[model samples]
Structure formats: structure tokens, C-alpha cells
Target: MIQRRLPIASASLLGLAAALSACASGNDLPSADTAASQVTTIGVNSYLWRASLEAVSFAPLLQADSAGGVIVTDWFANPENPAERVKLTVSILDQDLRADALRVAASRQVSQGGGWVDAPVQAATVQKLEDIILTKARELRRQAIAS
Candidate 1:
């Protein structure tokens, strides 16, 4: 099974992205380009799964997926490095079809050990996660606008 979250999930970041609709409020969308305009950056958060000091950047966020969520799992340089185990789950919410909207009100991570995604990810894994996240962001953006 795959973990689900919108914006950015995975224990690597202290803060990911979540929004009801990219809006500061429940009825307004943030600058359409705000998310996409922003450079795609990733960092570990203070969650139970603390990743090393490795950082990465890919694409920007640009979507409002209310159905599916984006997930990023992280691990230490050493695949089995217990010290580098970290994972998080992010959820995306699509409530309305208007400009009015609210970004993710809260964020959460499902910390556990199972599969690769269920567990922590390595550097290469990070790249894959980043790509998925960026794509999701853009898809959501288009869907939001269409709504």
C-alpha cells in the first residue's frame, strides 16, 4: 500500500505543503503562481523520523488535489542506518470549485517500518519522491483552476 498526502509528505521536512485549496482562507486561492513560483525545496522536520542534514530541490508546488495525496519517504545514507529513518504522510484537500479555499489546515506523518515508502528513503529515493511531488503539485494546480 502507498501512503498518501498532498503538498509534501515524508519525515524529511519539518514542514510540508497542505491546503484546502491553496487559499489563505477557505474561500480564496493563493497567488496561482505562488506555489509554482516558489522553488521546490525539501528539509527534514522534527518528527519522530529525523533525517540527516541532506537537502534537495526539484520543482515547485502548483496544484490542489482533494482526492489523492503526495507522499515522500526518507532514510539515512546507509539503507539500514537506524539513525536515518524518517517518514511522513501529507493529505491534500479539494473542497470547492471557486477561488475561495484554505490550504491544508493540519499536517501529519505516519511513522512506521514496512516497505521502502513505508520506511525511510535514501538519496536516490529522495529524487523519485521529489519528482512525484512536483508533478502532483502541478496537476493539482490545473485541476483547481478548472474547478
Candidate 2:
């Protein structure tokens, strides 16, 4: 009886895995391509980014190049200290707004230091949008820092 159950159990497990993969892999996206290439950073949307991610922990996302200077990292924070226990949805978008390497975004983050905060995140869209916002934010930040 156990031997016979193995095949049925295996089949059930396989089906469940397939269904999950489809959803988790983002295969059902409307388009893998979006307005990513044209994103230009004007300013940082840090607050919005944080809010978006607090609601949804998303899969990995990406972007291309930008025409601005600085990039932004969005992370959710505890109301007490917004930046304290924050979960950052980091982006590897350069001042140029390009995010080619998928892993690069994860490697670089505002959360490098130890903390009790989880890696704050939103859907991949938060990351994609950050590239757009950061191109400009980076430039502004650079200019401000220089001043």
C-alpha cells in the first residue's frame, strides 16, 4: 500500500510545485519589458518606496539605464524611526539608471550593517521604479553633498 501511495503522492507534489513555480517565477506578468529603459531619475521617492515594499515582499526585479545622477533605496521603517528598523528594497541602478546584473541590487544595500530589521521590500516594481527615481535623486544628492 505504501508503494502504491508513493506514485500518487509524488504526482500530487509535482503538480503543486508546478503551480507554485508559475506564480513565483512571475511567468504571468503582462510583459517582462516595461518602461524601464526610459526611466530618468529626478528625485528620490524614498517614502513611497518604503510604503510599497512594506505591503508586499516581491520577487527580484530589474531596470536599464538612467539620465540622472543618484539612485535611491526604498525600505520600510518603524514609525518610531523610519530609517531605524527598515526593510530596504535596494537597487543597483547607477546614476545612469542601469541595472543589468540581477544580483548586484541584492549585494549593495543600505542594510549592510547589522540590525533587527528585516530586508524591507516591495514587489519588484518598487525596485524598477527606484531606478527611475534614483537617476535624478543621485544627481541631486551628489550636488547637495558637494555643496
Candidate 3:
């Protein structure tokens, strides 16, 4: 399954890059009315998708499906705290750039007795991640418009 998805993910990233470059070249800039939101050639808002990827980029990705608007990150243990690890899943639920269009879920684990054990993730952590993604998405939209 991952082998099949590699091509699709690569193609999607290439398409997004091409689209963004086109936008940067001032050939396909959206009008003022639609520029604030709804800049998407894929299944979800390109800005949000890109922002989510950037937010979790420090971790290894397990799956990324642009058509399905899902990004799953493999377990990541911060260098400062190897005993604790986290995995993230981000879902882009809409084609428009809106606060409700993004969802972030996290699973946490802590090392116990030389073994990993599930730990509860704080609600604020999830909310903060969503906020970061949304902010970056909005910033990307603004830059796209400015360019």
C-alpha cells in the first residue's frame, strides 16, 4: 500500500508545486472575492494541506494522501525527551480555508519500565497544533495573494 501511495504522493506534491509556481508567476491569481479562501486544485485547500505538512515536518511521515486530505506522522521522540513520543494525524476536512476545516489528533506515549506505554495527550496540545496549522495556512494565502 505504501509503495502505491508513494507515486500518488509524489505526483500530488509535484502538482502543488506547479500550481504554486503558476500562482507566483502571476498567471492564475484568484480574484479578490475568491482569493481570501478556496485556493485548491486538490481535494482540500492547498494552503491548509501545505501548512499541516510543515507543522509536522519534524516527524517522519507514515502516510500522506492529498486526495483524501489525510497526513499521518510516525512516532517522534524529541531529542530533549526521548522517554516521551508522539504521533500525529492531520485531516483537512474542507476545500476552503476555515478554522473548522482542519483537525489535528495526537497520540502520546511515555517510556515506562523500559517499555512504551500509552499516555494521555493534552487538549491544549491538539488545539495549539490546529492553531499553528491554521495560522500558517492563512499566511500562505496572504503571500499567494501578494505574489
The number of the candidate with the highest lDDT is 3
Give a tens-digit lDDT track for model 2, residues 9-113: 999999999988897886575643223433334432332232223323433223212222223334444455444433233433322233342121322123335
**Which ranges in model 3 have alpha carbons more than 4 Å from their true place?**
1-36
What TM-score do all the candidates reach, one by one? 0.24, 0.21, 0.76
Model 2: residue 115 alpha-carbon error in angstroms: 11
lDDT against true structure, model 1: 0.32
Query: Against the correct fold, how does model 3 do in TM-score?
Result: 0.76
C-alpha local distance difference test of each model: 0.32, 0.41, 0.94
- Give the per-residue lDDT of model 1 (tens digit) for 3-105: 5553244643433334433554566744454323222222211110111111212212333122243333232233454433343333322222221111112
True lDDT of residue 26, candidate 1: 63
lDDT of 3 by residue, 1-147 (tens): 999999999999999999888889966766665455987777789999999999999999999999889999999999999999999999999999999999999999999999999999999999999999999999998887787
Q: How do the candidates rank by lDDT, highest first? A: 3, 2, 1
Q: Candidate 2: misplaced stretches above 4 Å? A: 1-76, 80-84, 89-120, 134-147
Better of 1 and 3 by TM-score: 3
Report the Cα lDDT for candidate 2: 0.41
Q: Which stretches of candidate 1 lie over 4 Å from their true place?
A: 1-121
